[model samples]
Target: MSTAEAGRGPRLVPVRAADGRVGWSLVAANGRRLAAAVRSYRSDRELASGICELLAERAVLRFVLSQREDRLWIWTAHLPARSTRAGAGGGEAVARSARGYLRRDQCRQSVAAFRQGADHVQRLRRLAGGAFPSSAW
Candidate 1:
């Protein structure tokens, strides 16, 4: 594991594949360590929606079972603009629309959609009975 400092208290370590893709782990001052990998796909709204469904499963498992507030935050990090089209406020607009329909107070649905867009890597981790540590979301 390679380590670098993140801000004041935590350290970040990257978990890399032979192909050079990286997943990360965050080590906090209190000894809490979280790790997760990130992956991006071609911009397709349908694929994005499917990812959200998978993430909802993970959120239920991670947050509800572990009682972790950080799960929601980690879930959001999975979304990043993968294409210029999606980047031109499209992804954000989609997310905003989802949130609007779900109602802001319904944290579960909001998080579920975020998973759809960004949390496939985490879903894999969950399937393997593991967790991804992320600072995004």
Candidate 2:
């Protein structure tokens, strides 16, 4: 088990690559990615959007992730519901739509890069969200 896995707290983190691209990932305490959740973006806004999508709420939606041949794929599934009818089999159903992403898009997250981006975003939020008093503003 990685340190991040053993460590407690938010499993997901935002990271920046050497090329200065930002990405989000689910990392372990050892700082290794749990899966290929890292996908880089040219700007922080794009990265934030991706993060939102990943963290977005789902109603009766469950996503299954799989890896094959150095690539990652996600398939959407929905919870089985009852129609107020008897003999209705309600179980996990596989989705027809499946999407695959390249492995290159998912690199192991670095603690340094993640901390840098996290700090920058948090600092921006504090300043822009009026965390300071009106007099300080």
Candidate 3:
């Protein structure tokens, strides 16, 4: 198993897409990517706001693990509804694993590792000009 899978905590790393849009990833201390934003943001301020929202809702967020038809297992994080009113099943997917796993056990382990470290996630400071050099899709 990799160091990240060994229960190491994760960090929030800024990433730049091919189109130059910026996003963020939850990466293990060993540099293994765990989860990432559902969509890219055009600016760091937007990215920071997104991160803040996620962090603020972390307590009520739910994590789900599923297997695709191709048999690849993956995990997704969802945000709960904002109100207790009827028809408020607002479980919107906000973050997902960076990659799919080959086995159900591995997928479960990834989820466990994520939960183990999510509460204490560290993030790098924003750079000047809002440019993140780490290339990610």
Candidate 4:
């Protein structure tokens, strides 16, 4: 039986990225990644809070697992919060589609990454003189 189906399902795991960056991801039971941080986080606390916020805001997330090129893989997406309140007085819904993961697992991770990516883009806009180039390290 798939580990996920064996009562474990998907879970958020603390990840120390290959470049030594740190973040969180919701992984399948087989230890395959479902979704992950777009970049990385400076601290674990930030990562935890980030994941929590993602769950609270986003309403849709997608995870796919399959075999490709002789390897098992995952693809994931975290769609933006739905605009249930849209109406004549409301402006047109802004487009927000953030997909992550060289490996994808589940919806929660995708949402977290989406919001995290938005935060990174905002950081880019506020870059000052010689402010470390980019959010990517």
What lDDT does model 1 reach? 0.37
- Residue 66: error of model 3 in Å? 1.5
Clash pairs (backbone) in predicted model 3? none
TM-score of every prediction relative to native: 0.27, 0.36, 0.73, 0.39
- Encode model 3's per-residue lDDT on 14-128: one tens digit a residue: 8899898998888877788888888899988888778777766777778888988888999988988778999988677888888899998898888777655455552211221
Tens digit per residue, CA lDDT, model 4, 32-96: 55455554667766765555455544344443334457453434344354466655333212222
Steric collisions counted per model: 10, 7, 0, 3
The candidate with the higher TM-score, 1 or 3, is 3
Judge candidate 1 at residue 59 and give its lDDT.
38
lDDT of every predicted structure (CA atoms) = 0.37, 0.41, 0.71, 0.44
Please name the candidate that would achieve the greatest TM-score relative to the true structure: 3
> Which RMSD values do the candidates have, in order?
14.7, 12.5, 6.5, 13.8
**Candidate 2 versus the native: TM-score?**
0.36
Off by over 4 Å in 2: 1-7, 29-32, 58-137
Q: How many clashes (backbone atoms < 3 Å, residues ≥3 apart in a chain or on different chains) does model 2 have?
A: 7
Q: Give the per-residue lDDT digits (tens) of candidate 1, residues 1-137.
A: 11222223343344455664444443344544433334423333433443444345443433221123433222233233347764354232112111122233455554454344344444333444554334221
Candidate 4 overall lDDT versus native: 0.44
Q: Measured by TM-score, how close is model 3 to the native structure?
A: 0.73
Candidate 1 residue pairs that clash: 34-133, 35-132, 35-133, 36-132, 36-133, 51-116, 52-115, 52-116, 76-137, 77-137
